[model samples]
Target: MEIIGYARVSTREQNLDLQLDALKEAGCKLIFEEKVSGVKDRPELDKALSYLREGDTFVIWKLDRLGRSLKDLVYIVDCLQKRKIAFKSIVDGIDTNSALGRCQFGIFASLAEYEREIIVERTRAGLQAAKERGKLTGRPIGLSEDAKRKAIAAKRLYENRDYSIDEICRILHIGSKATLYRYLRYEKVRLMNRRNK
Candidate 1:
């Protein structure tokens, strides 16, 4: 039976040394390490799961190291159980291969799921409160009024035969084709409104 360990950190700046060392001391025969955010999909984690077989053991330093959500943890543990493989989280003292460990895992998994649901509910409440308060969040407009004015002038110059689109864009210092097209479309809509009036 192979003892496989997995260690992961959220970002490149975070270190995996401690987890790796602990897994090694725990007698993990092979260890997989990846620097990836738990918030994002982890390709290595999927691969590690795919590599498991009956009678093999999977180890992680902590429960959160495997996954943060209770649903995620339960899903993983359940998958391992189906394969008749064992799982252990060193810090959390969770082992899913044994009877007592199995009972504890169910409790831990339930708690984890509860915690995740609470977070989701709280986030929804916060967003609803923000909306009620009329507080706008997220990135500000990409183009300011002054930039719009410059874009309009440049587009007009191009349309009037005073300059080519490329020359006008270069003179205006607009960096992208998309920006130029946006300004052009804005001007077209303005002209259409004038015609309708």
Candidate 2:
């Protein structure tokens, strides 16, 4: 029954030394470490989970280091319980192999899932209400009037053959090559429509 540990830090600037030291102290022979945000999937976490056998124990320095959301934490722990692999959160004092830990965690997981559902329902209601009120949700307005004018300028600059696409983009303060190409296409279509008319 090996004790495998996983450690995570959200950004490149953060350090994992403290968590690593703790895991080493806790008798973790093998530890996985990664610098990744909890919101995004961590490849190292998957690797660590895969390394565990049915009887092996998975160790983490803290619960938050494992997951950003309570729902995520509960789901992961549930999976471990089903696999009969023990889980230990050193900071939270949770050990799934124990009867008390199992009972308390079940309650915690249910509460977390319940809260997640409530949050989802509220967000959906809010979006529906905004749509009814004719207020734009999701991504805000894309192209501005100034951007439209710049698109026109981009077309002219490209046809003139004096300035490069990069030069035109720099002149217009366009951020990406994709956006520049899109603007150029929009202008091309507009010019064609005008000629056809």
Candidate 3:
């Protein structure tokens, strides 16, 4: 079985010697190191995970070095378990090969789930409060005055038939044929409303 190590520092200015030395002392045959924020994508971390095989031990100097949050950490560890690869964190004293370590990870998984549920509950409560207050939520209903003027102009240009749909959009600085069509529809509805009145 191979023992592989992964080390990371948040910034290029930070030294990785501490983590690297710890991993080397722990007998990691192959080590991958990266200098990147935990919240950002780490190509070296991805490479290290891809390099790990069944019966391999994925070692890290500290738990935070592996993931940005508890949820992310649990997900990575869960994937490792499914792949039959062991995980070890030297400073955190976590070893997936041990029963206590597995139990600790299980607690982390549960806490992550609880946190997600709480967020959903709070969001629902907020939406309900807004509804009770009769405040409009989400996108506004009508176009601005500038858009209405554009719609009127688009309709006039369309009725004249002097310009192609592409030319009309270009003349009006509209982004797409779809946006031009929407403007045309809006003007048609406004005209119909006026005729009814």
Candidate 4:
């Protein structure tokens, strides 16, 4: 069985020496290193994953070196497991070859799920409280200020009867006749509201 290693640093200013040295000490036969942010594409990581084979172990200095978040870590580990490739994180003491290591990974996945659920629950509760207080709990119901301005101009042009619908749309920078009609409807409603008030 072979031990393959992958190391990464978020920027060129950071050194991969520590992770590289640790992977070498761990007897990694092939090591891939890169300096890239976790949020960006990691070509070296893709290469390392492709190089791993069944009965091989993929090693990293730490779990964070392999993935940007717990969900990402779980996904990579899951893929490795499906390919019969073991995983090891030196600093994190994670080794998927043993039962305890497997359990630890499972706990990480569970924690990720639990965290997501808690966030959703808290958001729902907060929205409900806002509604109870008679506050707007969602998106505002009206055209934006810029759209309202365009709607007013379109309405005035339409009432002048000198410009065709298409001409008015072109003059007002509106996209379509349908849009111009919608804007005209908005202006009509606004004027009706003002009259009633």
Candidate 3 local lDDT, residue 86: 93
lDDT string, candidate 2, 13-40, tens digits: 8899999999999889999998865567
Stretches off by above 4 angstroms in model 3 are: 162-166, 189-197
Q: All models: lDDT?
A: 0.81, 0.85, 0.87, 0.87
> What is the C-alpha lDDT profile of model 3 across 1-197, one tens digit per residue?
99999999998788999999999999998999888655668899999999999999999999888888878888999999999999999998889899998898888899989988999999999999999999878988777888898888989987776777788788899899778778888877332222111
* Model 2, runs deviating above 4 Å: 124-197
Ranking by lDDT: 3, 4, 2, 1
Off by over 4 Å in 1: 7-27, 32-51, 64-84, 137-143, 157-176, 189-197
**How well is each residue in 85-160 modelled by candidate 1, as lDDT tens digits?**
9999999887887788999988877887788889999999998899899987665655679777976786677657
* Candidate 2 Cα deviation (angstroms), residue 12: 2.3
Candidate 4 least-lDDT 10 residues: 188-197
lDDT of 4 at 95: 95
* Clashes by residue pair, model 2: none
Better of 2 and 3 by lDDT: 3
- Which ten residues in a row are the worst by lDDT in model 2? 188-197
Could you tell me the lDDT of residue 106 within candidate 1? 80
By TM-score, the better pick of 1 and 3 is 3
Shift in Å, residue 150, candidate 4: 1.3
lDDT of 4 by residue, 103-138 (tens): 999999898888889999999999999999999966
